[model samples]
Target: MSNGPAGHVARSTVRPNYETGRRGPIRTFLRSADGILIDSVYDPGAVVYGSAENPADAGRSPTRDLVFVVAHGFTGDVDRPHVRRVAGRLRAHGAVVTFSFRGHGRSGGRSTVGDKEVLDLAAAVEWARGLGHVRVATVGFSMGGSVVLRHAALHSGTVDAVVSVSAPARWYYRGTAPMRRLHWLVTRPEGRLVGRYGLRTRIHHRDWDPVPLSPAEAVPRIAPAPLLIVHGDRDGYFPLDHPRMLAEAAGDHGELWVEAGMGHAENAADDGLLSRIGRWAAVKAG
Candidate 1:
């Protein structure tokens, strides 16, 4: 690991008996629209056991032909355990690119919550495409979920498929305790201070100059490119109506899955669920 300007860090590892002759996962910083240096990592999928039923040539096929760009939720970065786990599971289906949004982890700038996050996701998606992957799918959770939806809508034809989990359909929702607390966390100076110190996330102290499009409004423009909306039935944040509204806006092009007994975002996503999502993205990209 080596550190660079503006809190950027690059990390890679060497493996023995390497056949691909490629270096370890590439880690670097990408510049967002507003000049924020977004920390990112790209992992070229290695051969892994495909399925229990197929043993002979199961691990021979590599998933590097496709790419999945993963965007994490609020306060989550590429290095977080849950984020790493999500990336690991998706590697079975394709190459994985994960990034830390502005104001999170080592990335510079303050979070506009989800308002300006579309640029962050856009940067990551662009970086993924630059890596020579023919197909790219974006998967995001919570705030990052909203970011992916808006990014896909704003930059048409940039992504092949999109998966948004536990995202709010509209903004300014405070129906639940967590949402209420989150609003407090993003709306007040004290809250921003707490977020910066306690959560390691820096919340911008100003309101959106011109409020961005809501996720529900953005979903309509994402057609032709497949979309998957996954929300937990028991989610404490935004409830099922959020996903329902988003899916409804997406019409025939969108698929909705309301997982029972699940909660919120990436931390609540199990390995089985992640694998299923990865496979779904790979199939959709095909």
Candidate 2:
């Protein structure tokens, strides 16, 4: 709940206007794509760029601008460094909104890895749309990336562009060499104690389900909307091949950025990466 060293809390700070303490009104609506009315809210600061018409609804608009939505990684809130960095850059250009996942930070319920996150994303998108973000773009990290991928596949028509940095399309984490070790390390009594007793985190189920709830199963359904896949060369956790697989599934519609020394969406404030993402979003939103 404290700000970063720079005094910025990214998306964690509660907006005074949203008296409920939850972002927006925490409302729910049924999305035609998924046949579910999910929870969501419009960011008070979100704005439409370039077009007068809302991006979610295609119609005559004064400007066809874009809004950027920032999603955080696993165990991370909207105020994490990565989210803050991206939010700062995107906000400098226009409206930028970020929110915590359910059961994470200020939201309600427990983390569902990437499954329930789809609902969280739907809510965020709906909120952005309500704020007049006619052209919506998303930037997500780690597990957040997987959520974005799933959302795009389900609501391709509404999402104008997506930037998934450090997301592995297919999940075989328990099979990866390092992940194998890390899994052993984390699932052990000591690690489990830290995550459970120390952090008091709850698992969806105990034992036997370490395999990431993969989003690769949803990749084939995503396309047409421009997607940029950014991965670090040293990300042993997600594996480099994961991005390659996701890009391949994109079938010439997606672009990949493997940073030389980057790791898991690190250095998000770097000028080059920021510029690339911003430009990519601009072009895609158009």
What tens-digit string does per-residue lDDT give for candidate 2 at 204-227? 334435444456666667777888
- Among the numbered candidates, top TM-score falls to 1
Error of 1 at 220 (Å): 0.6
Q: Per-residue lDDT for 127-245 in model 1, tens only?
A: 77766678999999999999999989999999999999999999999999999999999998898899999998998888887889999999999989999999999999998889999
In candidate 2 the C-alpha lDDT for residue 195 amounts to: 47
Deviation from truth (RMSD, Å), model 2: 8.3
Candidate 1 residue runs with Cα over 4 Å from true position = 1-23, 48-64
- The TM-scores of all predictions, comma-separated, are 0.89, 0.71
